[model samples]
Target: MKGLVGNMGIAHLRYPTAGSSANSEAQPFYVNSPYGVVLAHNGNLVNAEKLKVHLDQDVHRHINTDSDSELLLNVFAAELEKKGKVRVNDEDIFTALEGVYKLCVGGYACVGMLAGYSLIGFRDPHGIRPLVFGTRTKADGAKDYMLSSESVVLKAQGFTEWRDILPGEAVIIPKDTMTPVFKQVTQPLSYSPDIFEYVYFARPDSVIDGISVYRSHLAMGDMLAENIAKRFGGRETLSDFIDVVIPVPDTARNAALQCAVNLDLPYREGFVKNRYIGRTFIMPNQKERKSSVRRKLNAMGLEFKGKNVLLVDDSIVRGTTSKEIVQMAREAGAKKVYFASCAPAIRYNHIYGIDLADTRALVGYGRNNQEIADVIGADDVIYQELDDLVKSVLASGNNDKITGFEVGVFTGEYITGVEAGYFKHLENLREYNARFKQNSILAGDDPKAEVDIGIYNEGDY
Candidate 1:
């Protein structure tokens, strides 16, 4: 391993948001094209089917996999091939990327090696996902630039100066030059970085698009606190309604603290999290998610024995986990249970890169506050408002760079345009997979059964 050598190399983790877990579908997907490119991307192409057709018919290229990242790589390759150069410079790369921005839709933050030529990176025009850039100087005083989906990596790796690569911006490091050049390939359009990154996806220590993720989470708590207060009169009346503020654990801790502070309630660790359990939200199927949820947290009966507990979570997607937690609270002898969400209701599918493809599976879909509370077995439910989410994040700083965020799941208006029938396509896929998942759960069989239309998982395609 120590003997491995290259001018530059890229490593990527495929989270399966838009592809299968097969080894063949893993990324840093390599392509022998205009200059021989190896590309890795963190996003899902909403128009991948259309792009595949275009690539085959218009560009005369073939996509070997159903992975959207592969389609994006081929698109980039085809565009570069159009430049009629075996080896190209930054200008050619940006021109080719402009073609990508025009034809492809949904979120993408891409990084790649242009063979022996250059290291290239770019983000979608709307910045639905995140990419941060950093620079460091070697002992000899030559500078090296790094790009990643999170800033914590750059910080951990000793990069001196780091910042977000803006939406529609491209950074190129030519093999010969070694100096990284930044180019705005597309117009400086309105940016709508995904709000969920701040809420769930990113590490709390990270900073995305110039906003500190930890602070954003804390601010979300602050907003949740404010909303909670308004729902139950002023802060003075909160204690009468709620005895203690509790977090679902890990992600919701910061927000829970803020909620407790604003409402003048005692903050308590009412639920003991089993750190060994993986996140239920990212699990592939309903059975895994439900099983993980049941095993992931244990109620502290001492805390909930006679208290009215208000539980805070980053978001409520399916509500299955919330119901389990609420039942745990009840079993622990709690007089009442209240649930609060730092994010608004998730009612629509996210075409960007998240695996939440079925609107029907969302607990908050078509349900009002009281209805959501009823479904989750909570005495009351509170969710952060859309405007407050924007305000809280903006207040953290960088009001100039990020004027707003993509609340597409909550608002159902994709920042990037979606073609007609896209929702229908997603629903059909999710329904097909849901049947298989349901059968697996009922039979207590292996959960990885395949559906008929499965090029991959329901959300990926």
Candidate 2:
């Protein structure tokens, strides 16, 4: 609050994966007006493109990025300007922005406004993304409220003791008053975070929807060891030597350690990350996939040489990266390789916000586990059961139950009828109906995924 800066400052970085792969498309767009509102968003907005179209025509706003924050700021600034006032109340801003969104389907979003009369913060109802807030009192006795997609970012800046913001809830902070206003924008949509995210994307240190990301993977690793034992009970074959549990780079480290503990085997980091490669799962097509592998993964000669190793990873979506990695491991003089998936088959594509599209493009879409193992060149593969998945990722205790949105519906046991013809942000789908015909690559019932990043081609992984 006090001594913050000349005009307030906010920073944002993009982890662009599941969609396009351009830095120009990154986030943290700023107003820089006397208003000086700097906006950053973490997750996807199902309707941001639509909102952009609305802003372009109705408000004459041009978007710098394909993100919801840009669309939102345009709407807020336009609405405020339309009201012909230098400042607008929080209620007035939220009332104008509402759209259909989901959690398990992806897209957790956070919005912040600095150098404005009042700062507003919000999260998707399903909380598909993560956001945390902290407050500091300035020398001038003004309150400074800060928000980030991850709490540790603020913690690194000396912000601590954060509380989770419920989905669909918005908090308004004013300079003159320490008092805050809370408003509900829409209903809760999805689960806190996908179980796979803990096994992969999120930092193990984070708490997603109250679930400890690291701890859950530890449990998954343990479960996987048990599954492996059951699969190869009393075999004692060359492949059953059980030399060491090798993790697939960063995401599987925690789970690999846990698997070692569960199976009483040694653990080691067998693959080194490129440190410069982006997640190919987030980018579209096979070019990024090849580049990501060449730039992202390397074999650990010492850990893999002439040894029968168990390679553990969070999930194998395209089977491209994992396949290449496995081949490299074999070339590293490994006697045998066994692969394990910490979660069950990702057959269904995520409609939320993640990059996973539909079943057609999914390597495991029409294939079974053994088939996937063959494709990826692993000697054996095992996966955690779905029930155990929810149990492990969501904290277990009378008080540690999982709730934020109806994640049970995620299994497709219950379906939220898809809303169509009204989406604003997603383009290239006007031909999704009646005109769409199935080709060799587009053979599926899902219309949304008939094209690139089509929802139907995205397998569960």
Candidate 3:
């Protein structure tokens, strides 16, 4: 990417949600028509399958990949084509975005570049995804614009003046003028950013939708401490029950530390994380995820031996990692292992963007607190209450506009109401992918094989 030279460009690191993990499915997806536009999208579109059909039949646009991002790019292009303009302008781009908002449904934040014309950014009507932009003035007084899913990127690159792009809003920065035009292309349904951002996905340093991620984690810890105290009978009995608080690794560290401070328990780095190992929860298969947990973190005997240790993690998804970590703690001579999740039990599939396990595959699904504890081989399991989790995020920032959050994983009710049969469709896709992976392993094929299982395309039908 460093070798590529361009004054104005958009980039993306694909986290597979609505498509295959094939290299071809990666963004920034491009469309040659309607003035050579390229786009990078941050969230999943629930209506992608319907949109694909509309593009193919109504607009005559051919989609190459199974990616919804490609569908999104072509959607905007088709809308721009409707203008019948020889040369497009900022207004046309925003009008195209209005079409996109109307046609596409679900949580998405997008950044697009119109060839030799403009850079564009927009968000879903519900604001279930995060998008922010910032500007820096060049020495000649021309302003350089940047758009990202997080504020940290803008600040890191010295774009000091920044603000979140509002829900249902679009921003167009023309290359010729270098001036950005902002507009609310559609009426916002709600101002609900995904709560999972604070729990797992985002960097602690980044602020999303005016809420500081770091501060939210601290608040989560405070809430978790209160919950833990209740579990231990009272706040005064917390020290009697728990010997040490140990964070699972990087993401849980902040909350764990704050939890320890609130509970007056000693916080210890009980597990040494191997920085090279990628996050195990997002791993494609259960087998890989199960194996990677051991490689990712090693339990220190000194911290666990003869002690009643409380393990803190951001969240327990499939319980593969948590179960292994608990076993490791026991092997390290811990007398008792009490597991704590900073977020509530994630029982439903996260259709927004984060590719959590299927609903049935989740540890929390069809399980009470004790059942979950038994599955994870812990003495007890503590989950953050949904209300407390919401409060934790709300306590941190300018949350006046945010009346709620996209918490489908916890509640099974989404901001954009789920379409009929979508959950079944999503489950089928996941099962197919899992089977494909198993077959690849048996046949000794590349694990990352480019096998398309017809997720968002016409093939699914």
RMSD of each: 4.4, 8.1, 3.1
Q: How do the residues 1-461 of candidate 3 rate in per-residue lDDT, one tens digit apiece?
A: 67888789988985668666777677888878878989999888887778877988899888776577888889899999999988987778878788888899888999989889888899998898899989988789878889998899988998889999999999998887888899999988999999999899999999999999999999999999999999999987787789999999999999999999999999999999999999888899778998999899998899999999999999999999999999999999999999999999989999988778779999999999999999999999999999999999999998698869989899988889877777776775666566665664435322333633232433444
Query: Among these predicted structures, which one has the highest TM-score?
Result: 3
Cα misplacement distance, residue 404 of candidate 2 (Å): 6.7
Q: Which consecutive 10 residues in model 2 have the weakest lDDT in total?
A: 449-458
lDDT comparing candidate 3 with the true structure? 0.88
Say which candidate scores most in lDDT. Answer: 3
- For model 2, residues 275-346, the per-residue Cα lDDT tens digits are 877777755556668668867888879998989888888877778777888888899888888888886766
> In candidate 3, residue 161 scores what lDDT?
90
lDDT of 1: 0.83
List the candidates' TM-scores in order: 0.91, 0.75, 0.94
Q: Model 2: how far is 102 from its true place, Å?
A: 13
Off by over 4 Å in 1: 1-3, 428-461
